[model samples]
Target: MDYSLLSQAPLFKGLTADNIVTILSTVPHRVKKFQSGSMISQSGEPVNSLIVVISGVVKGEMVDYTGRVIKIEDIPAPGALAAAFMFGDRNRFPVNVIAVSDGELLLIEKPDFLKLLMRNDIILVNFMDMISNRSQFLSEKIKFLNFKTIKGKLAHYILQKAGKDKLSLKLDKTQNDLADFFGVARPSVARALREMEEEGYIEAKGKYIKLIDKKGLADLTIE
Candidate 1:
């Protein structure tokens, strides 16, 4: 087996494949495979193990009161799922993690993971740092959720990414995926783009977005 998969997980970072093999010989872990569209982990489920993806992509999502499925984020292989949830008082996952494609996951029990951390000061410190970073990321996600309009969200996102000046759209998301990300309907996103163009706020051709009026976009973000 290519124990190198261990290197991909944040918890097992810096450990060589041989070292990972040695560690795994004593640690309790099991690998599970998921088909595309399968729910890897459910929201409100009793959290126990730390899930590390060895291959493929998974999306963390949740439904709001209005039955809108908001995608929290996407996790590609070699990423740990919900690493921040392992220690907190309310440790349950806030979102459902569903596989976007065929994937393999390594499940390590909390106690076993904790045991590994106990013997390694580096691992413990790295774990804490990971959680701290996750907290900051969640805070940003909350801020993103606060945008009142699709245009406001799009303006905020474009400005935040490529800056508040003239630039091409630097999006890593498809139109449908971007719509899901904004927690809005696809037509709404399309309408917002059309409205922006008609209002002379932006000049967009395909994926390219030239900020015609940066100040106007900024004002819309706040309004």
Candidate 2:
């Protein structure tokens, strides 16, 4: 186990070396590796344990009644708590957590985990902060989905991912994945991307998208 990486996790931030060693001694440690597109947790499944990502990315997505997929959030970094449903009253997961790349994870059973949290105030605060951040992110995503046009939603998404006015992104996702992320049909996303390309707002290659006119895309997000 990489204790250094574990120490860097927000949940363990500010923890002394001795404290981390103590926590590790108390908890049983195991590492599980997963491949891309593998489901870490499925919707409606029992939340028996808490999963911490040791490496790679994971995405939370949900499919609606009409079979339309909506991307809830993307976990781009490590130390992401993938099965947070266990923290609430409902034991079943609400969304599917899928691995976006080949990665490793650590799992701790819910019962023993709660015991650890009960004895540690720092761990409890860290867990609460993680949940609160996720809630805020979901709220923002809901607002993005309410946009009247596919173009508007896509524009908002691109700008949000870019994190800056001028940026480049390796869009490894297929058109279908983009459709799922934007909560629109495949054809709708394709058309919107084409329009953006034509308008010089973006440039798309096989698996790369370059932001050419970020201001134009950002403008679409404004009322």
Candidate 3:
């Protein structure tokens, strides 16, 4: 694999070709393939390394004491870090990372990984930026969960999946997944979805959802 392409990543931006190669060479890089629904990291597992997604999507989720699994976030793009829980003092992963599709990951252990960061200030800054972005996203998620109503949260979540105005995006999520994401019962999610469909804000057929009225969903956004 060409390590230079990895340097193009935000986590390695500004690093020289030589430095990138050196870091990549030092790390015991392995390509791990996981089938869909396979758990890459489970809750309470040791946070030994960082896993970078090279292909496909991964979903982070945590299960409650009642055995309810809550889907936290989705990592859809290549070069996105799959496990941010390894960043600091937390040695055990709090959430489970499951493969949303057949995917490949590049794993780098913590000690050597931190050594690489220490060797390159650019890499260190990039790491800091990634953590900062993750923090901001988590804060927003907290607000969304705590303040927004289920209807409002569902609208925003569907909008994110839709991506563009045309809403030609395919959502491979099930009603159960949507329920977990919104922290509601499956019946509640179904009710909310039905309401949205009735209002002509969205159209859902099987695994595909199209946003028919962006403004309608946008208007549902809570303060």
Winner by lDDT: 1
Model 3 bad stretches (over 4 Å) = 2-8, 14-22, 77-83, 140-223
Q: Which candidate wins on TM-score?
A: 1
- TM accuracy, model 3: 0.58
Runs in model 2 deviating more than 4 A are 16-18, 82-84, 136-223
**Model 1 poorest 10 in a row by lDDT:** 163-172
Model 2 lDDT, full chain set? 0.79
Query: How much is 201 displaced in model 1, in angstroms?
Result: 0.7
CA deviation > 4 Å runs, candidate 1 = 26-45, 53-81, 93-105, 121-133, 164-169
Candidate 3: residue 213 Cα off by (Å): 25
Query: The CA-based lDDT of model 3 is what?
Result: 0.76
lDDT of 1 by residue, 83-123 (tens): 87777787888799999999798888999988978877766
TM per candidate comes to 0.70, 0.58, 0.58
Error of 2 at 152 (Å): 14
